[model samples]
Target: MNLNPDQITNYANTFIKVLIDYSPKLISAFIILFAGLYIIRLINRFIRSIMVKRNLDPTLTRFLADILLWVLRVVLFVSFISKLGIETSSFVAILGAMGLAVGLSLQGSLSNFAGGMLIILFKPFQVGNTIEAQGVTGTVCEIQIFVTKLITANNQTIFIPNGSLSNGNIINYSLQNFRRADLTIAISYETDIKKVKEIITAVLANNPKVLKIPAAEVSVKNLTDSAIQLAVRPWATNEDFWGVYADTLENCKQAFDAQGIVIQPYVRESSKSSS
Candidate 1:
């Protein structure tokens, strides 16, 4: 392997020519990489500022900003490599295929994550708020990326998938300042309806938790063979909802007893026939 002097000279010239031809592209790619990264950073910071001004949840803001940053970085990376004469179509195709495969395998997890994002963004319910959703009624304890934690009235902790929670009807009890408690009381048909309404209205007015602005309503909801159903509606602050509900019921019962207004039992068709 002895090379002639002319052959060696020719090889050196070829190497220098190749480097000269590619140097501009290499420099341009480096510049683009740095400039694109700086632009991405600025965009992320601007997004974070907007989110903060909007009072978005801190966790959600950070998560979304990071996602945006990475996505922009990926696009910039493709651009940078393409500048240096590297083909990016195949690279992008490979990435897309991998993303699809991972997405299919984690369908449920992805769905839950998306649901969590929606819940956080929309704020249908917040931590410490009592809500009824998907047949579960409890105070929201935590909002995670995949599930929401709730503490039931019985003090049991339950984790509900965000996917179902976001899709289902949500009754946020704490959203409004006041909540109306609907108490249905059945009394013997023999009792005077006017007297019953007066007694229940007095009971609601006596309760300190009940709101007076809306005025407590006491109306006959239905009349059965043995009883009259009275709909006793009372409004109270969210903090006093359960207390007002329980106390109102107890006070109404005591009031009825004092006035000798007996609560009638439900007489079913089968029981009536047997009797």
Candidate 2:
């Protein structure tokens, strides 16, 4: 079938009207969307520089900066879409719903993350410091956003979750410039307590690492069922704690042996006080 001239003319007019109505708006929306992406990227660079200047943790800096960039880009895209006369309320509502769902699913993790932030802010321990936390005692090897690393006294590396650390007690042993190297040497009941105390004090004085300022006290702390407990407490610099402890024990044994003071058995945990 052949169309009439008026029919052809009417079809051409309709096509031209549609192009004029939609083409400019579509082009403008596309430009706005692309410009928004570029702007967001520039903003991200600015945020990253600020984070660096502020000396933020590298991992935390990246995490927070990335989230910021994504928020801006999403907002820009939503605005651009709306400019093209598309409805965004439903889209935003869907996003909010999805976000809520995600949040619910990650509640435990989120709580843990918040706890981790608290830990970092409070700074109970730093890397290489000896600490006891969450029932695990060790030296700190690393600290991160979600976990803390510990090197055990027995040479074991432990990774404890940040949530557990923040919830439990933290014992930082490295904070003090000096530490007391506590030692207890028990002598048999027959041994003269006064003689043992005098001899122990003399031995401690010879050790250079043991501080003289504390005056190296020797006291008969208890008369146990097995023996008389003569406690030797010597102060030393924190760095020399283990060395002084070892040397004191070894030298004290030799000194006591020369005087014929018999050593008692090592005591394990017992609530039964010295009888």
Candidate 3:
């Protein structure tokens, strides 16, 4: 426990000498790190602006930008580490091992990511498109890196993993400029088929929503045990598809009532009353 002023002085001088020797390198490394970060941000923004101007797919643009930004950040981090005189070979090896572990654990996520990439590249369906897939029907809201968001007709939000969506059959109702509304209504067996068709045709002709080019038609689709099934096929713009569908059914029902055509009840009534 004896105090040594000479030893303390020697330690202080040695510390100061080491600091002075590395000060320039430390300062240079800090400057480079800051400059690199700033440049990276600038590049990210520049790339985003370019993609926006080119009208590139938003999903793919955002995904690629994120990837580029992260890769640049990782490279900059490695550079900063190397500047501190730390060997990066071991650091990179550690990162690789960690990445492999994460990749293995997130196999499904990786599959979804690949599927998302395929969706963006193939252009199967885009945002705002009404699609039916995986036993669900909805309008595509957003296509993210791993999942596709859909807004159902009943105002429900659905998130479908890209892996499943990409592999399954996707019915893109909005792919065409126009969509056909397929409807079936059962009428009494005694109802005249020819007159019913005429009445439905007239109703369709009056409705402004129905596309005139395709010309809506009504025909006997099937003869069920209870009633005759009439098929109503009408075309309308993709945007007006749902509106036309609902309107057509309503108008047809009113027309049938006015024309004295009997629309049979779905559930048949028993002739004998319960005691």
| Candidate that scores best on TM-score | 3
Q: Supply every candidate's count of residue pairs whose N, Cα or C atoms clash at under 3 angstroms.
A: 0, 0, 0
lDDT of 2 at 17: 99
What candidate 2 gets wrong by more than 4 Å, as runs, is 1-70, 73-86, 266-275
Q: Evaluate residue 52 in candidate 2 and report its C-alpha lDDT on the 0 to 100 scale.
A: 98
lDDT of 3: 0.91
For model 3, which pairs clash?
none
- The candidate with the higher TM-score, 1 or 2, is 2
> Measured by TM-score, how close is model 2 to the native structure?
0.76
Per-residue C-alpha lDDT of model 2 across residues 48-160, encoded as one tens digit per residue: 99989999866567768877988898888898889888899999999999999999998877777877778667777777789988788899877776788899989999998
TM-scores vs. true structure, each candidate: 0.74, 0.76, 0.90
Better of 2 and 3 by lDDT: 3
Q: Which digits, one per residue and each the tens of the lDDT, describe model 3 over residues 157-223?
A: 9999999999999999987999889999888878888888888898899989889998777888988
Off by over 4 Å in 1: 1-50, 72-87, 267-275
Question: Deviation in angstroms for 197 in model 2?
Answer: 2.0
